[model samples]
Target: MNRIAAPELDIRASADEAAPPLERPMRITILQGAFLPVPALMGGAVEKVWHEMGRQFAAAGHTVTHVSRSHPSLPAEEVVDGVRYLRVPGSDTPRSLAWLKVLDLFYTLRARKALPAADILVTNTFWAPLLLAGARHLGALVVSVQRMPKGQMRWYRKAACWHTVSSAVRDAILAEVPGTEEKIRVIPNPLPESQGSGDDGRLGAKEKVLLYAGRLHPEKGIELFLDALRVEAVRSVLVREGWRIEIVGPWSAAEGGGGESWMDRLRKHAEGLSVTFTGPVHDPALLRDYYQRAAIFVYPSLARTGETFGVAPLEAMAQGAVPVVSDLECFRDFIRDGVNGRIVRVEGESGVADLAEVLQKLMVDADERTRLAQAALAVRTSHAPERVAAMFLKDFALLSTLAVKVSH
Candidate 1:
């Protein structure tokens, strides 16, 4: 296996005046499902978190290698943002295919074999827990970055340390995997500095657009958003006010167990409505444009399965869009009601009306929207990547010590 190592930097202590002595940089291998250097198919928060983590680890005197499934359109291997990337070919089918599953398993095993010697192994999701276990068997310290409260607790217990994106997620993991509380650590999602010019001040003239920018599946609450729009009052307001609904995401029938036929059904239902389906926006700059023009950011996530942490609202908030999200446990952590954004109770169709009311208020009242926008900006600045990177470094150092003790 060819080994590519970036030069190591000195790790400095904040209070010390002198440069810290150089130490051997720890080699870390991060296993992720899908790495989206291209924007279109990067569906969840985990993509951004893991990507940033790898970059930060590399910068902080560590050789970080990230392994994930490669898109059919892209090369099998490429380096981006100063981090080493190894892409394994896999199917993009929405539904699970036996052959694809086998390929994923085969590639993960292959990745374990081909990667450089690593002092630590970090697995992002439950699907890759088995791979982490394999890494542990290789005598590497295993760290599981738990993003959801699924049935992977037993497997994750074998990890030397578990890092969660939010406290709510940590609590959920504890509930499911009792006696593993000591192993869990909470680190919130990091927001990158805003690089684009947002909203061109032409608010009223622009169509009153409501934006939903993740997967168009039921779990993401797209169906709920659509169903809510179908209410008499909701429909009346949108039609009367000339508001348009825009669904910007990768839509496929396989995504929600319904093949392309499912996408056709969604489109058919949205015929008369002022809704434009812009398949997928891969470019961050273009996606930011959608966020800026959007009157309200709605994330009405319904499916409880793997709906752990939401990074979309944070990104939208960074662009100064008020988020109207479902009362999911993950959203409850960052979204404070009437502070930065509004949260509607998740109770089927009723939740939609609650979100609709908030959207309606934001549309008409400029002052309220402006206040929320400023608050959103404040939230975004607080979650800046440099600050988040520092926090992760500190936590990783602490965990590294604890992990060594546990291993001993």
Candidate 2:
């Protein structure tokens, strides 16, 4: 087999005394899933993240290419925000997980030929790491594990590095496939830079909206949110104070949501309450507006296995909405109980009371809510796009150096 050609590392110091050293830029390729589009016009967390990161990478003088499913409004191949976007024939999400994986396999095969010559290939796809493990054209395979691993990590041992969005996901990978600790790297997802708006960060000035932004699936605990609303204390606050819950996200299965049947159940459960379903808002500005206007952001996810890093909660917190999340270990990386946000313990079925209590306190106590929201702003700088991108770049540089040494 031919040896991969790694990018040269440039660690030359800057001319200015205050400026940082100039680093080398590599050709970076990011392969997304077959279901979502690149520009994130249809709304997928991974898509939006990589799209933004691709732009950031390109802005820093790196050649970034993002390949994902094609959309009607977007060109099949075009350069946007300095990043080259290449789209291929793709399909809507299937109802069955097995079928989705099968589709992913076919998509991966198609996406392989579309990949340009690159020094580093970053992907969260099911088959990219397996298919391109020994590809001579691509230099380090960075497998981004955004979700929990289910026996898949065993096959991905050959990857140069495994990027886990949270420590919980890294732990899951080790539990399923041990002895890969040296290959794993924990990096939290970054907040979108476009989320910056001139909106007031004051909690008292925000709307009386209690927001829940994510896919309308059972795993996200939408029903549990409604159940919490049904609690007499929460209901009294809503009725007396006129606080409304706005559920935003795709509800159809095609957009990676619980199908209509699940939505029907949610509607039935949410009866006689001040709830509004805004459907799926794909625009970043509009989504940020929802986060901006809301006083509290509630994400009661029960997907212990499926939930990795809570991007929605992070985005909400960025907009100064005090996040109320379930006690999932993935959330612990950013959310601290009663500090930046509230973590309600979800034990089987008993956690609803705890959820209700937290909501009631936030709704009633303005001082406490403002304090948490102010603290949450710390994520803006901590998980900023530049900071996260720098972490990836450092890892890429290390991997490239290692590859060059091995090749020699």
Candidate 3:
């Protein structure tokens, strides 16, 4: 893989008085698997991260183009903020992971042409390296992002760099490709700053509402959340007062969810309970308001799909909700047991019991909830977009140098 210097952008307020010449604004492109709508439409963690990254890159005076699958409502070509989105025709969702892979593979071949010629290509698609030959022609340094644990590793052999959201994800990749340790870097997802408009939703309030936001998939532990909410200890408090459980997310056949079967089952299972299912709140202002209104946010994800950094809980924390999440390996990045957020075990009969007890305790204890909410707000500062963006920009500046060294 011969290297070429990425063309510079005119980002200078004046030339590099602080930054090196090579550190000048560079064209960056971010790619995701087919039809994962950008956040403006309805997307998951990967899309959210890609949209935020592109905005950050563009804000820092770089040209950014996001290449993603098109939606019926969104225009084929549109520029939002400073980032230009180039949405190509692709499917809405697939029946299973195997099928999703086939769709991703086909989309990769087509992406080569849709992808912009740029200095760096940061992607979450499993088959990005399949386009390495095409990427090389654009002089783009391909950085493979480990979005999940089970992606195909052979394709990564062609990537110039690998970005991991957590050490667990990095380990998962290294276990498959041991020789690439030198190329890997752990970068936590950058959280956008609070819009500063909603209520803090801190604990110790008169009324408490529990909230869960994100995908309604089985693995995400929505079932467990509903079950725990039914527990005698949890149920008694909610029914006694007028407290409610609000579950908000997007679930559709088009979004890879099996239409209404899973949701119908969940609702039927929670019959007689006061649980409201608000399907996929896409408006940022409205979503932020939900988080701000939440007294406690719970995410009991139990899937073994290499659960990497869970973003919903982080967002909840930023919005001043006392987050209660399952004890997953990746969550240790921010969650400190009883310190910042509550950590519950939901694996077995005993684990479920623990989760029920944790929720019960948080519901009853006001001062403790307030204490946790205070620490939880640190998520906004620690993972601020400016800080995370600076880290990636620093590395992008050195990619040319790294490319030269690796080409040997």
Candidate 4:
């Protein structure tokens, strides 16, 4: 397929730069999927990202409208934080992934009727790219590929641009559908300012807590984290030193988790460890409190294909917690092994032992932990919300200019 080459995007906007004039604003529409609400009350990563981005876009003098699922508490149509939100009747997340896609298709059909005219239509829904292919009045369709595509990219040929959060996702798409290099752009997620903000006293009073946030799924390597804690060396640190592990996030299959059976299995495995299973904390300000108090954060994800990006660990890093992650290509985009964070090779039977060793080392060495923690704080600026929003706006500007679709 022949494609129009993407224009060079300049996203060098800093804190000192002036905002765009209100008279010349881009009309932007963000369409979220069927499950979560706009304010991200239920803790969906994709929803939270676009929600924050929508607010930032609006603040930067763009006319923004965010269309999302309707919640009982939220109004059907209202403006919050400078962005307009339109909520459509939506369904709860079903058990099966296949069924979820079916619901997304139906929701897209419903949402299509409510969409307003815009210069750019940004969406991460399963069917929006294909469904809105002929929506010329809604302007350019910029699909946010937040996950690895399952042979869906070829059908989304009408998308003006594909925004991927990391090179890992971008490479996965290119591998699945060759000749799509020109239509893809890699933009890292921004660390919400709330996650990075806290008193310096919080950093100084970091506890001996190892934090693990995100869905309680098998692919997330929670089982591996449990197995590592079962190791005698790690158990010694937890028992003798009074160190504790906190496993946070939802565990139901409907909430993008591994199901209740998986959660039960994890609980059984963690019989004697100092592990606490704290459920999902949707509020960013409250989640930041957990990150601020933790001395270390671990995300030993084993999802080679399912894991697109690690947002939880990044938030923890912003709060000055030293991160120890699995050796995933997605994490390499931000985390440099032994510099800002530790990356453990968890590929084989020795994986548990490898993870245990890293945990034990960080648990004992306060100085080394502080060193990595300080360096990890740099993500505040690198992945700052303002900086990443600028990157997206740049791409949106370029794609809007080259709205003519070309394919062979």
Candidate 5:
């Protein structure tokens, strides 16, 4: 794909030359419980979104601070692409639930004191909303980024404003808390452009690779994907076509156990299959490399319990990989069947049959793959960092004007 440079914005200087007085940049702080440059803590899509938002805000002349739990491997305070990151020390509890609550309290207090006085406090997860509420009390405007369950609606309503990555999430938020329709805004997931040569030559020489890049668990429909692949016809067709499957993601204790035990079960069921489990590839650059090399991106998600937004597919699409997603609310907003990508409906027990059909057809037809891939590439440009940053700045400007009006 041909790369296009992001359009530069004009920023006015402060009214001083000799002294070069410091401009009062909009101080914006983002509160997330878990964020690290490593995969163990921060490989998730939410973390990627947070990082992108921070970079964009800083580029737009805002002093953005990202507050999250400290991983021992990372620096307590560091700057990545101009965004200041502060990682607070987490708790030592063994239990996941207890540790999460403990970390929440720890980071909240730490962030309150450490973060410079900000014009806006943007809380990413539901757990951090209480902290943002406190920030609001301290006279900072609060914008809650809803990415979790409806149970946290009370906290969301307390926010000065709300935004989410998808319309499904916004609807869920409104459903939980009435009269918040106006407060909620939808900004699609901002996926960084793939930084690789768009040479199909690299993929042409290798076996057709179908990539599933995300958490491997029940909600993500990994079992369903494997089950679908187990069908004799599907297996025979894929093997005959020399199509290899790769699953790249971290094992979550949240999905049961994180060790090889779960993987052993998957392997036992996937006997004689050409599947490679690459564990968790944390680096975004490496992940994008996989995206560029893969022939198709498949997301067979069925459950929405912990699935808020579909970021992987967007990233895959950005790299010109055609996405094959399950019929889910979040996916329906962007993926137009037969246009940008294909959507397989999940009905009854036939998990991979519909997906198998779609994949088989896409793998065989070169023209269809190229067309869809191009369309997918086009779709992602709208969600590029600069574009998403402009959307956010527009929203912030609107909110600021509204605040001034209300104050008078």
Candidate 6:
């Protein structure tokens, strides 16, 4: 990789001796690929993390800047919640294919020219760690956050460190690039606490309700969710008990959705079933309410994106809802079968049958639900954003310091 040379600076001697500041905060910049930041609450999990983490880093006294796709409604540059937002090209378009990485390549080159000097340059982009490797040579500690298991070691060779979202991703990366393990760290996504739930870890003032919140992509497994509901035993309980299965998300192509046609297809399949598609609740408060009310939460995502670390189930867990997810290695990073939540096997002879059976169990037995829900609530504090942010800052600072020492 070609290294970018740092600019030469002229130092002048001063007559008076002055003491340096006791504490200096790190200057951090996050490249959010093509995700929007401001007025981008509904979809795009990548942007959601940048917005939240940017604010937390800024609040912790670090100077933070976020570079993401720009919106016409949002300004080209502005400060929100202490983080400075810098808009780059590619807002008019969303959900483009891998070819769009060409745009990302150009964007990184453009950002390198204009972005202020930083101690840390963090990116969630798959090829960015390698694409923007020159930033590391310029004295910025380049960190790649592996949100999915998609690429090889070449993509991460120049990164100061790779923050894997789960152990599955960490192992996958190590399998291909065993030499990078020393520079890899596993950090789970941060969770914001749920509101409106009572002290006893109980749910809303209603009956049995099932909930699903995420993108309406095929990999997300909305069809599987509807299929599980087709089982006679599961269907009987939902119909007889007057329960509702609510699917909440932004299923439009612009918001990284599977497009309206696919959503329409899902609705057709859900016909005659007590299913409600409350398409993409933008308000965080309203989303939390849905989590708090739903007694059973199901996420059967079978996407080929490696179905990396998920944030939806943890949010539902915080709201005291029992989560029933497909057997994804990402969920296993935290969820324990019949403990904090239940994981259904989706590969065997009775895949759908097992899911339906688990849903029926949660619906019929309140004690098991209570036990899991309470344990779910108990984990919220440990994964709180504040604690997660502190861990992130510590890891970030340590890596940056090490880079500076090596350069010296």
**For every model shown, what is its TM-score relative to the native structure?**
0.82, 0.93, 0.88, 0.93, 0.85, 0.88
Better of 4 and 5 by TM-score: 4
> What TM-score should be assigned to candidate 6?
0.88
What C-alpha lDDT does candidate 2 achieve relative to the native structure?
0.84
Worst 10 residues of 6 by lDDT: 1-10
Mind giving the per-residue lDDT tens digits that candidate 5 earns over 1-408? 111122231211222311112344566777765433322354657667767777878877777888776777888898877788887765432336666666667656776676666666777644556655645433345554545554777655667677777667877877788787877788777775423324344334323788999877657777777777767767887878888889998765542324467777876777778889887887777998888888789898876755666889988887778888887777766777777788787556554677667777787887898788877775444566666676777666566556547657
Residue 287 local lDDT, model 2: 91
For this target, which candidate reaches the highest lDDT against the unseen true structure? 4
Q: What is the C-alpha lDDT of each candidate?
A: 0.65, 0.84, 0.74, 0.85, 0.68, 0.72
Q: How many angstroms is residue 206 displaced in model 1 relative to the true structure, after the best TM-score fit? A: 7.8
Query: Distance (Å) between predicted and true CA of 90, model 5?
Result: 2.2
- Over the full model, what C-alpha lDDT does candidate 1 score relative to the true structure? 0.65
**Which is better, 3 or 6, measured by lDDT?**
3
Off by over 4 Å in 1: 1-24, 34-44, 97-103, 125-128, 131-147, 192-207, 253-258, 402-408
Query: Candidate 6 lDDT, tens digit per residue, 282-346?
Result: 67789888987889889987853566778898888878888888877778776777667887775
Per-residue C-alpha lDDT of model 3 across residues 290-325, encoded as one tens digit per residue: 887887899888854557888888888878888888
- Runs in model 4 with CA error above 4 Å? 1-23, 194-199, 404-408
Error of 6 at 33 (Å): 0.9
lDDT of 4 by residue, 161-279 (tens): 89999888998999998998999999888776633333366568899999999988888898888888888998988889999889889988768888888788889998888889989
lDDT of 2 by residue, 251-281 (tens): 9989888899888988989889989999999
